[model samples]
Target chain A: MTQLVRVQSFSVSSDGFGSGEGQSLERPFGSLDPADLHAWAFATASWVGRREPGGSRGLDDYFSRDFSNGIGAEIMGRNKFGPQRGPWQDLSWQGWWGDDPPFHTPVFVLTHHLRPSFSLTDTTFHFLDASPEEALATAKQAANGGDVRIGGGVATVREFLAAGLVDVLHIAVVPITAGRGERLWDSPDELLDRYHLEKVPSVSGVVHHLFWRD
Target chain B: MTQLVRVQSFSVSSDGFGSGEGQSLERPFGSLDPADLHAWAFATASWVGRREPGGSRGLDDYFSRDFSNGIGAEIMGRNKFGPQRGPWQDLSWQGWWGDDPPFHTPVFVLTHHLRPSFSLTDTTFHFLDASPEEALATAKQAANGGDVRIGGGVATVREFLAAGLVDVLHIAVVPITAGRGERLWDSPDELLDRYHLEKVPSVSGVVHHLFWRD
Candidate 1:
């Protein structure tokens, strides 16, 4: 089986902003409310860590559930891991996720300041100061022949995409637009030469755009 | 009936550029190929002045036909009329369209340098050096209570939209991205507060985004 690098269920505003600016603990996705951008995923029945029993079932739910399907390891930016800017001021901050984190596989956090690895539940957080290419090689080995997911916070995804390392990218374009945020691409058309793109709009008002290489 | 300003079958690349820069006679939509941006409309059976007999009959065809329906007048930027900038270098340049233009209604061209009005068949080209509000008033009068159509060249559509004069907008989001061009909006979500938005994806890999104010 060919090992694939995929971005599943990543949400972006209509204007192509993945997250807002000044992302911090109070504002995980910048000034924009996380609920607005992620309501589609959370409303889905298959979303992990759902508070209620019932959620909508169908296309949204199907894609939401696919987030964790084939991923053996995950690679995320430091911003996704926490709000700390430069050096890790506070080691106690495991992540925005509580004690029992979602990912059951090894999750590599890309950062300039590396730290000792730590484990919580089934997920182990490994800090790495490596380029996209270097990080991908490490994650691919840890993936154990399975797929590796490029877990994003915008900048990381853009870097990997610029490096032409991502095999598949599924972006959920929410109806709302982020006036100011971390932009995914100055012009997404820059990738047009390298990838085959498709758009599928769901009844929930979100357009699911898929990009892949043949 | 209430006056409605609608944008029908307007296409844009995934990156949100309606048209590329340096638009000229040979390159209608600037650097971007006209066929690439308008293939969806041309393939439709209802596209006006299609030389060929046969075309696709489906959702695209439906939207293509909707372009002229109920539209009594059109408001467009000077660029949509011709590529000549500053002053009209040639009065012979009627429009990119041949003798029989698609718009049978009075078409208002917004320009700083006004020219005498002329007629071709049932369509009349009226050049006006007026603001968006002033131009719309003239177009509304020519519309004779029928709906007005905002024929775009990106900047014109953005101006009308920003002015909150657009009653409805149907933007066809093509799969390909334009690396550089005139952008419609920095973040389309700014309109979310005023209009109800919806996205409908078609089989042609284009997402039809509809925005309406009640």
Candidate 2:
């Protein structure tokens, strides 16, 4: 099978905002609390933060369980890595994912300001100042035969999506609208020109809009 | 039972647009086609335009069936009545819905330029220059014991929605996005303070967002 560039389990609000304005360490999603938006995934059995037993089954659980499946590496924006901007101030700083980060594979962070690579547990972080194509090339190499996941902070996903590198995208559209934030789409129909779209509404009230390029 | 002022079977794109820009006689919804946005309702057995037999019999059909349930009168913006704007130069032009209007009751047309009220089949068109509250009150009186429907033109819906006069609002969130045109809400969450909401995704891919006042 050809290695696909995929986006999985990315959550966006009903009004199309990916992350709200003023993203910081304390508030990762800025004004729009991701916790509220991501309640569907949080209630799933396969959620990373699930400490208690017995989570939801079916549609939501399936997406959560398949999050890391068939994907080797992740390519995300600088903001998704952390809140630090304009040249990394702290060399000691790592990602927001804590001690055992989610991705067990190589991760690429897109940024203008470069930082030395570091490893935490099974995940390794590599900072690169490269075009979307170049970054994908690097990510694909690390991905090996497995597919590459385009993890997002909105801008990164937009960049890669605009470059026409994304193969399959799955966006979990939450019901709430964040009045202010960076929008993932002016309209999801913008992608319908190139990709076939399928909107699957889960029992949790989240509609999973899946787009795939043939 | 309390007489409700409801917005039933109103359609909006995924990006929140009620209609597209450049609305004219030929294009009532401007860029966004109401036919496409209302495909689910059209496919149902309760569609007004249905000629032959056989139509979908699911959630979409339920909404279509309930379109005229307790609705005794309709209050619509000038645009919804027709493409004509400003001073009504054409007195002969009845409406876009032909001789037999779908609304079989008193229809209050909100416009600054008033026209002599006329009757077509069972429906009567009454032109008025009134505020949302005033129009609604008039419609309620005309409706008798039945409910009044806030028929929309995007701007009119926004006005009634903002004025807090709407009792129950049903919006069909279609997957496509009309990038331009009038937006109904910045986010659906804006009305959460005043109303309770339930988003039910149908088999026909239309998510019906129902909001009701207590």
Candidate 3:
């Protein structure tokens, strides 16, 4: 049988903008030192190599390593594509990776715009104009037997979650708050009972919470 | 003068069982294969170090190191606290970090239940039975001059975001779709327009999209 799964997600804060204020783009994450957040890095598995002398090691390292398991393809949204507005131009935007991108598998981008197949050194970006269900079907096929992943600009994930399509959620709750902007988890409180807590840890003071269905 | 900021958030896929399956406490992240997901780790600055054969270095290493900046203090919800049901069980649950946790700083937990000023090694877990705003106030004070971080179990971050208290959001768009679970972007579409794209990339196929508001 085909088993579906959801990964982890969390919210980031932004400063409410003033009409006079320009896009400052201040990275509040920069307030702490890279070494200080070693714990969160470990949990998300976003960490790669050692930064300083005693960079990332030990349990943080263990969890960081644990983050990269399992499988298949990925799904994302256009707002996440880049600063570009309107329809996707071409494969020229090969993502933020310089040359050799990370994902070695096929990726499905959820978009309203119709675009042709785009390829990178190790990955292919296929545009999905259909509903999320259609996208999932394609991603699953592309993933083969592995598992289909959902990459989001929020809307995409929300669409799936509303349909009860996610299996697991590993969220790294950062220790920052934005007084304004987009909100996550505004649904009815009854929805809270759908899942149970799996793991919760303060990695380098960053809260890494995991949730799953009973 | 204190400056208020907006919240920027995106969603990512988790394994399955956001918190865990019907509540099976075993392997929360679920059987992960280390080799295939190396890219997911490389993008978020969430991973630690070592494990990969040629391992990871440079910008990939920066992914792990970048998280250690600007955080002064942290606040989290019970969801981010762990799978414990009910509450007030003593200082026994000093959090999953055990003693001498990775976070050598002060951490505040938003909870209905109260516990003594719990201390694990260098980190102190302060349980605040207060609203998100109140928690932010205390966290800011604890943060000194640095930024206050709000760690979440989902609802917590949503609460803050709706209140417009978050400042900077860094999201790593993972490649996976959950056929069922909770969502982060159920908010009205007009609310999300404030955030403009900051960065994006395709590493190992998984696209890492970061967003922020000036």
Candidate 4:
């Protein structure tokens, strides 16, 4: 009964360095305020740990609470799952998290390299050596009745979108613009009709935009 | 002395809601693992604030060290600067940062709204009513020979790259792939020649790629 319901995406100022200026191995997130990189901010532990607080409620908080609900399984590309050095050697990396990664369900990792499956706490990392379609099929199986989440780097997301597999997309259009970096939706103007803008108004000036394939 | 550099980019997951599942104002950062999300890890105060510590020295540490160098100004789109709630109310929403922000230098915010200048610390927020070209000119002037960092959401970066105005772009090439959402390089592949891959290696497993536009 698993269904691919939505694909949420937001852009990053790759600079490979992280966030914005002064980007390097040290400040990987860049020099901009963490709040500005709201897309990546949701992945931080500090942000996750504060959600349970009893005294918080606002527009920002509202979006945060809504995004995390009902995720059956997560899918991502190799680059998103770090070490950045190259082919994973022993799978010892286990990601940046220690023993318990935040993704506590079945997480499928898309890669060209094949490696043994790894698991921790409530999450299990399944390395798939197949195309996005194959990966989706496996994720659907694991999702049981939940929706499949498409994790991304850029290339992987494009593959799925080009094939018209994504159902719903939410983009937290942050206010900042990196003058130089990667191009998102660098698609021609003719492709504009492929998706429709569902929402734009949100708190803190962050435009919560949703696009769905027509 | 305006020069062009390469810029790289990728995507992050936000679900249909702007924030990830389980995010709240109290815990705005989200479910990010410090390890998997290496970029943010190097960015935390625990790591970036370590220039005072003279003992650390690894490839990661080296890049981190180089990141703290001198820079003059930051340029970001209106979406990256704050939310899209339209116009300024009393400026109560300074940003997602709590009090002291990260950028101490002058910051140029591109927007169509006419609002008074908002200055904080060494960072003077100037809202540009003109086009991206005009904003870049103003930012370069403020840079004073320093690098003009392009802060972004996505469209902003694409606009600048399309104009051929960047100098260096480093893309972290995260391994994850979102089947949908936004893309980093959805533009014409012909523009690939505009940038040359300066460096490509793995940091922990994450491929650190540097693209320089010559």
What is the C-alpha local distance difference test score of each model?
Answer: 0.83, 0.84, 0.51, 0.54
TM-score (chain A only) of candidate 2: 0.97
Candidate 4 positional error at A83, Å: 3.5
Worst 10 residues of 4 chain B by lDDT: B10-19
Better of 1 and 2 by lDDT: 2
Q: What DockQ does each prediction reach against the true complex?
A: 0.03, 0.01, 0.02, 0.01
lDDT of 3 at A184: 41
Q: Which candidate gets the maximum lDDT versus the true structure? A: 2
Q: Considering the two chains of model 4, state its CAPRI-style docking category.
A: incorrect
lDDT of 1 by residue, B93-133 (tens): 79886799999999999999988999999999999999889
Docking class of 2: incorrect
Off by over 4 Å in 2: B1-214
Candidate 3: where are CA atoms >4 Å away?
A: A1-214, B1-11, B14-39, B42-55, B58-63, B186-191
Question: Considering only N, C-alpha and C atoms within 3 Å, which residue pairs clash in candidate 2?
Answer: none
Q: Summarize candidate 3's per-residue lDDT along A1-214 as a digit string, tens digits.
A: 3344555333322221101111122322233222332335633323534233233332233345333334578777764444344666655665543455455678787767767887777778777787877777788888877666665545566678887877656555455443443344542232467764433333255444455564
Per-residue C-alpha lDDT of model 4 across residues A1-214, encoded as one tens digit per residue = 2264556545443222113444343343345544556643353222443444232222233334334445678888775565344576765667654577766779888877767878898888888888878888888889877778776645566778787777656555566666543344542232356764434343345555555543
What TM-score, computed on C-alpha atoms, does each candidate reach? 0.51, 0.51, 0.43, 0.43
List model 1 lDDT by residue over A1-214, tens digit each: 5688988889999888989888878889878888999999988755877866666544565467667766889999999998988887788878887888888899999999988899999999999999999999999999998789999989899899889899878788899978898988655566779876666667889977767676
| DockQ-based class of model 1 | incorrect
| Pick by lDDT: 2 or 4, better one | 2
Model 3 DockQ class: incorrect
After superposition, the stretches of candidate 4 with alpha carbons farther than 4 Å from their true spots are A9-35, A39-56, A187-191, B1-214
Q: Which ten residues in a row have the lowest lDDT in candidate 1 chain A?
A: A53-62
